[model samples]
Target chain A: MSIAFFAAFFLAWQYSIVWFDIPRYILTPPSVIVTKGWADIDRLLYYTWITGVEVVLGYAVAVILALPLGLAIAFSSILRRTIYPFVVCVEMVPKIAFAPLFISWLGFGLLPKVIIVFLVCFFPIVLNAILAFSSLSEELSRFSVSTGASVWRTFVKVRLPAALPQCFVGFKYAAINATVGAAIAEFIGSDQGLGFYIQIVTGNMRPDLAFAGIFFLTILGLALFGLVTLAERLLIPWHISVRHQSR
Target chain B: MNPLIELTGVQKVFGAGPGALHAFGPVDMKIEKGEFVSLLGPSGCGKSTLMLMIAGLLDATGGRIAIDGRTVVGPQTDIGIMFQDNTLVPWRTVRGNIELQLELRGLSTAAHRASVDELLASVHLEDFQRRYPHELSGGMQQRAAFCQALVHQPATMLLDEPLGKLDAMTREAIRTDLQALWIQRHPTVVFVTHSIEEAIQLSTHVAIITPRPGRVERIISVDLPYPRDFEVKSSPQFIGYVRQAQEIFRGYGVL
Candidate 1:
């Protein structure tokens, strides 16, 4: 960690004028993203927390709602016929175009931002879940049901495990979607968050702080992705990817 | 004792249109308790379809399938089935696969621990109990499948070409193991296979069916006694039976 920090420090110190030509505006240089990242640390921490909460809550809501809905669309021919087309229609609708209307109805509150994030992140989970469920090999399904498994049991025991790999694909996509959704929500409304900070600072032409805000959002997205990857590993250790990694 | 299973006028038809296909026909069959019967037919001859109907995985368009005089409307816990593919869930270990029936019955894990171990030992898979299906060879996977079918101690077992995936040597070895396991469990068994020699080696009765829109062409009883050996394959008795079954197939224009 120290070596990486010094290397970055050494390179930035050697070439600060080349990277950020605005002398007065450059502030403390690459070191400042960390130092001011600490000085405005409270604001940094606050917005980070808000955006983190929004991303997590929005992603959680998407998963909770997506799972059963996805399972239904994947497993039941009737439900798939009834609801899948409508889901696709809603998913294709431009979520960003509704930002002004969301602010108007939801009153520039956290609720609007969360709703936007949910809208953006929900589709992948549902679509991937459906795909995963559909992809289960027929023989496995037959085996479970023939062994006296009820429909629900067959789904839980056989279908769910079979779908986990695809579900992870959905989760990975949702994590990125959550961050972008949170940023867009903060762009339109909200008093605080990395997205809010980015919008406010960028309007006043504080590109350095804007870049910092962008940096934190990237970190948050990466962290969420890392958590999901950890979960995937735990849930399916026998999976080829996990098995190969272990070896 | 009365026969363990009866299939009367069983028929299966697919789709409804001018181009609709008929894969099987109305047929009558019976298997005594503890007997191994083979429904021998080529692919699409409705052998697997017949097995599915008897397993209660599919409904018959015409006729009844009964287990010990009880009509089968849907799958019953007393009947276990295995398909041609090794259907072990890739996520489950060998022991977990075998314990699936017990899990369905909501049998306490503690209650079945010893039995699960016994089945693993019987399939000669005790050492690989913790290994996943993908970790096992094709033969091991099929053995795990067989163990899973018999785990709940079903009164009858339906095997749809269970050893079809293995190589010739593994196929022979598994066939031997399957026969031994069948005797040990003593479940009335119906196995579907295209191999004439397999039918001769494994079955008390071999029922040959004609091609698509299949019907029973002949039912050849192998009066030769049980615990059949490899030598039985080269015997005059076996040769005679094979020739007769072949003639029946020839009559149906299947050979």
Candidate 2:
């Protein structure tokens, strides 16, 4: 169903561009984008790999840092009261405002792009992790204690697994934000990556190549999202949301 | 021998000062070892509050609750609890949930495998042991919960409406299973329920309680034989006991 819709939309796009006599430099047709993509497959793949690496690495770093920080905050009222407001304050600032600062400190290389991605993706992971841990059912906690489970046992056996489904919600959001962060960082200043490639091609009046880079970015975002979903299925098959989905 | 569970002047108040709400009790009760006692009351009667105190999940504003001669300062290893909700961890299989008791007690998987299997067999859920809680029917989930409570072999079980959420047929089936299980294990059980019939059907004694600022209105001995089956529900003696309980509730303005 979705495939047919996209196919028809592409045909309309192709015909409308020709019928309106739109200049190729402004809005390239689907055929032109595809031809450009095919002709520059090697270059596209190379730059796509760079952006993909930045996104995955930044997302991985964000999850690693956010989970423990979230747990610490959730477990302790002192930390939650002190750190949570500061986190919200920092999150409220426009993340793009940090791009120039990051580039200046880390230079116009992959480091700045990855850091920007990490900054963009960090808040959701932390917030979701905190919410997941804190929102565990009181009944489960009571049952755990009544069964004589130690604090550590309750955390590992009950709390951690219970938090997984909500944590995956953050992961999905972070996956998409990861690509956008990488792209925004590259747009500001970078030497290599899909975003850099698009900037170069568009400046040189090659919308076809620019559109090709965009197509690859969309695929990258989707693939990363798919990976997060796959991990969720593997880790929490017993979750109500996931269980019903299978049926 | 001392009573398995003893409560003297137990009470709970939700807050302090002028706004304080007296939730339940200035009540005393006792159950001998291996007895089935039902706490019968109306909605909002604080029956569950009393159970929580006995399980050491909540503190009484005043008075004492002791199990096996030890005061319940906090949740103890020797007591098992099941609430109205199944409380099954969603990410675990039926077998996995049952094994949680053993795991929490520091028993390794290899050591507890046989016991877990036996628990599943007893509940007739051996075939569905690998299924997750959401995949099972309500009765099955309750059965799995019962196994989770029993697997650790606690000497006393505190159940707060454990089977209250099931359909009538499912409830009857699980009640039968519970009776059979109880006969075999003989754990001292304090079951909280609003159903007078349920209280009489299972318990050796029924502790009838009044609403908010709940007190033990009366205690009635069931005097029914063990291994009770569905036929007991239709028996004239059972009807007499139900009538006696209803009259008490009527006097208390609860019926």
Candidate 3:
């Protein structure tokens, strides 16, 4: 049903562009964009793969770094107090402002793009991790303690599992932000990636090609988001959110 | 023999200085071995707090608690607790939840498989052993929690209204199940509940507590026989005990 609605909407969009006599440079019809996308399929796929790698790698790195950082902050009030303000300070600065600095530091290569993605994806993972760990029910904690579970055992068996549903929430947000970060980095400085392709096509007054690049980028973002959702379902099948989703 | 559990001058204060709220206090009690004692009181009467202290999950601001002649400096392995919420780890199946108790005691699954099976059978949850907590109803989850709490056969059990969330019918059924289990195992139990009939039905002695800064207002002894069923609740003897407990609660303006 949803697919049918989307198809009808796209057909209407195509007809509306022609009916309104809009120029291709300003607004490309869906049919024209599809044809242009087919013509540039090789280059588009290549760039899409590059962007995909950067987004996935950056997201993986962010998950690795943010989970433990969040756990550390959640476990200790002193550490939370000491480090939270610094995190907020860094997050307060628009991450895009760091694009030139990253390009300068790492040279306009994959490293800079990856770092941009990492920076964009980091905050949500950490915030959600902190929220998940800290917000654990007191009853659960008490039950764990009553079981005479060691601090380490309690963390591994109870705390970690309890925090997982919320952490997946962070993972979903980070996955989407990762794509944005990669695109933004490519926008500022990159020779490859869909973002650079979009820049080239638009500069050459080919809105159809630019829109094709955008179409692939949207697909990439959705694919990444879908993968995270799948992983969440696989890993935490017992979570209430996941169970409800099945229904 | 010494009391299985003892609390002397035990008190809990939430904060310090003038703004401090005295939650429960100066409460003294001795629970004998193989006894089912219910701490009954109104909500916010610190019944849960008192249970926490006994379970060694919370420290009393003043006084001390000892179990089996040992001062409770920390959580002891011999004590088991079931909270108001079932607290079943969402990720674990019913069998997995029951096995957690054995695991914590360093017992291998192979060694305790029979016990786990028996517990599930006793609760009539053998069919649902592979189901996760989310798949179970509230009563089933509570039963799984009860199995988890007792799987290792801890010497003492601290239950904080473990069936408070169940519907009336389910509550009564589980109450009977719990009584049968207690009869079989005879562990020293400190059951906290707000329901007067629940306390009377399960406990050998009902320790009626006052409101906040809770103290044992009185201890009402129920001389009912063991292996009690639902029929016992309708008996004249049961009515007499319930009326006596109600009268005491009314006297303290807690009813």
Task: Please give the distance, in angstroms, between residue A243's alpha carbon in candidate 3 and its true position after superposition.
Answer: 2.1
Error of 2 at B106 (Å): 1.0
> What is the Cα-based TM-score of model 1?
0.89
- Total clashing residue pairs per candidate? 0, 0, 0
Off by over 4 Å in 1: A1-40, A72-79, A132-137, A149-156, A245-247, B247-255
Q: lDDT tens string, model 2, B98-203?
A: 8887787777778878988888888899999999888899999999999998887888899999988888898888888888889988999999998898899999
Candidate 1 overall Cα lDDT vs. reference? 0.84
Ranking by TM-score: 3, 2, 1
Write candidate 1's Cα lDDT for B126-244 as tens digits.
99999989988999899999988888877788899998878989889889888887777777899999989899899989998888888887888898866777787778998899999
Error of 3 at B193 (Å): 1.0
Candidate 2 CAPRI grade: medium
Candidate 1's residue-wise lDDT over A60-161, tens digit each? 999999988998898789988889999999889988788778888988778888888888889989999999989977677666667676777776777778
| Better candidate by DockQ, 1 or 2 | 2
Kindly report which residue pairs in candidate 3 clash with one another: none
The full ranking of all candidates by lDDT, starting with the best, is 2, 3, 1
lDDT of 3 by residue, B43-127 (tens): 9989999998888888889998999898887766677789888878888899988887676566788988898899899999999
Error of 1 at B149 (Å): 0.3
Error of 3 at B203 (Å): 1.6
**Candidate 3 chain B, which ten residues in sequence have the lowest lDDT sum?**
B98-107
